[model samples]
Target: MAAPIFSLAFALLLRLTYATAQVDPALISRACEYAKGGPTCVAWLQDNEDDAELSGIDRSDPDSIAFFSLKKIEKEAVTVSEAVSAKLSAGTTEDLSPATQQGLAECKDHYVPAVDLIKEGVDSLAGKAYPDAMKFLRTSTLDLIACQKSLAKLRTDKKDTEADVHATDAINRRDLLASHVALAQSILEFAASGGGAAAASVAAPPS
Candidate 1:
């Protein structure tokens, strides 16, 4: 009887483990293939597998993966926006030029709106309003690009090392967000087309 109880306990543990296991590699590959930057999408998903909100999701479903990606993007946008705001608030003490200060303020302006758009996009995604979600996401991307370009212009005109550093960082982060936006768009497109095995099969394998 004790042996049977032990076996049952082990079986339950195995079941729990399986329930919480990472998404299947094949599934991740298949879903990521839809993104413009497949490898980046894969890396993001892999790195965020343990995210509190993502961990509870059914990662096997392409739609769920897309939703998770959108939420992640929203979170990133919010974080970047807050960082910019913090920088602006603390800039009073920094030896920043007036032009640099204005540029950073503009970046904050762009980022604040971008965060709002991303949040709206996430909400639309949750509601299965794919078109609205994509529209909002695309607009958010534009805002991020504008912020990046603002920094670039400042860096170019001022030739300030600090501005250059900020521009470089913004470029890298914007590019990552763009990739995630593309990923979410592709998955949303698949879902809009009646996502299933059939819709998934239409995508060509990643090179």
Candidate 2:
């Protein structure tokens, strides 16, 4: 009886191990192939494997991975918005020109709304409302574009190299946000087209 029980326990353990295994690298590669960021998308997802929200997901499913990516985009938007706010606050003591200050303020305005749109997108995705999710995600990019334009105006009217530097830094952050959004959109497209539909049935949103 002891031998039989021990064998059954070991079998159960094996099943559990397989059930919770890491996401398949090939699946990630295939899904990321359609992303605008391609290799960068793959690396980003892999690098964020330990993220609190991502760590609990069904990594084997492309849909779950795609959902995770959207959550990441929302977080990034919030982070960028906060950083821009901080920069604007520091302008008083940072030797920033009026034009540079205005540009940073505009970027903050755009990013602040973008964070809300991204949150809505994540909620839509969690509910399996694909069209709504896509709509929100796409709309969020409008703010990013607006922010980029603000930075561009700063660069065009830059008073000094310092203003240029500030514009460049903001642009880099905005570009990263855009890339993540594109990657998330691509992953959603893949999932909706038969790559995986597990997200449609997921019981809870990422924490």
Candidate 3:
């Protein structure tokens, strides 16, 4: 009787192991198709598929994966916006010209809509409101561009200064946010084609 019990436990362990190892390849392929960096996306998904945030999600479903990917990108965009805001605020303390200061102010104003738009877009996508999500995503992209233009208008007067460095940093942050926006747009398109979940079961993947 003990032998039979041990045999049953071993069989259950084997089944559990197989289930844990069964990740769908198509989900990785689909994510690569939509993300900006295909190789990076593929590698990231493979490495982070077992993260806590991805727990309970079916690795075989491409739609679930895409929805989680969009939400992750949304969170990343918010971080980038915060970094850009910090850089802009730091620039205000430097010896910037009056015009440059005003431009920085305008840049801050542009970011006001930029930060929350991605979050709204994510929520809209979760609700299956495709049009609204797309609008918010596109508007967020526009806001990033507008922020860059505001920084461009600022005359640094010389290169390698603190203000110039911070402005450049802001531009880099904008570009990062732009990539997230693009990724979000692609995911939204996929979800619109009946990819998003009817209910929010899947959460974000790894960083």
Candidate 4:
């Protein structure tokens, strides 16, 4: 009798758990919208990763996966910085084309928060809280992925309306940046989920 009762309770709990679990696949959508399709962060990552794989540029050198990931995050960061610089250079913060303006804003608000989370995750990993660190990186990765998909949509929407080759190049660049950011974000998430280190090896102890 007791065994039957225990089984019933277990089944009931499982049902309740499943009923309350809500996964928001669209969470990234909100993040992407916030950044408005900016791609600076993404493009930087791909270029560097390509260099690493093709030319042996190993700034981070975290085992193959971790090393590649660090290189990628650095790339995204550089791209983000460059985008900010471009915006300043253009002097068109408010006057940007609608798509560009939207992407820039999203990056500052939504995508940036994701970047911050990943940074915290990286820091946490160094402090021995692997689980917590992975959480932050994973969250950031999801949001960045959403940001990428949105930027692609934004590019498709704007490509035809570009005024000339120069204008087209600018739009393409933004899309490229977004793509790279998305890829980097995904890579980070993959690392965090696996419980493997994404950081470079520690220094050797003195004898």
- Scored by TM-score, the top model is 2
lDDT of 3 by residue, 44-127 (tens): 445543544434333455545554555565555555556656656666666677777777677778776776776666555555
lDDT of 4: 0.43
Give the whole-model CA lDDT for all candidates, comma-separated.
0.64, 0.69, 0.60, 0.43
Runs of candidate 2 with Cα error greater than 4 angstroms are 1-22, 155-167, 196-207
lDDT of 1 by residue, 1-207 (tens): 445544653453355345663465666676666554568767776666456655544456665666667777877776666665555555554555678678878887898888888777666656666777778877787788777775654433444445355555655666667667777777666655555355542332232
Output the TM-score of candidate 3: 0.64
lDDT per residue for candidate 2 within 74-171, as digits (tens), equals 87887777666665665665567688788878888888778888777666655556676777788889999988877666533324544344455666
Which is the better candidate, 1 or 4, if ranked by TM-score?
Answer: 1
For each candidate, give its TM-score against the true structure: 0.71, 0.74, 0.64, 0.40
Which model is ahead, 2 or 3, in terms of TM-score?
A: 2
- Against the hidden true structure, what lDDT does model 1 obtain? 0.64
Q: Which ten residues in a row have the lowest lDDT in candidate 3?
A: 198-207
Superior by TM-score: candidate 1 or candidate 2: 2
Q: TM-score rank, highest first?
A: 2, 1, 3, 4
User: In model 1, what lDDT does residue 175 have?
Assistant: 67
Residue ranges of candidate 3 with Cα displaced over 4 Å: 1-25, 34-37, 40-60, 154-161, 195-207
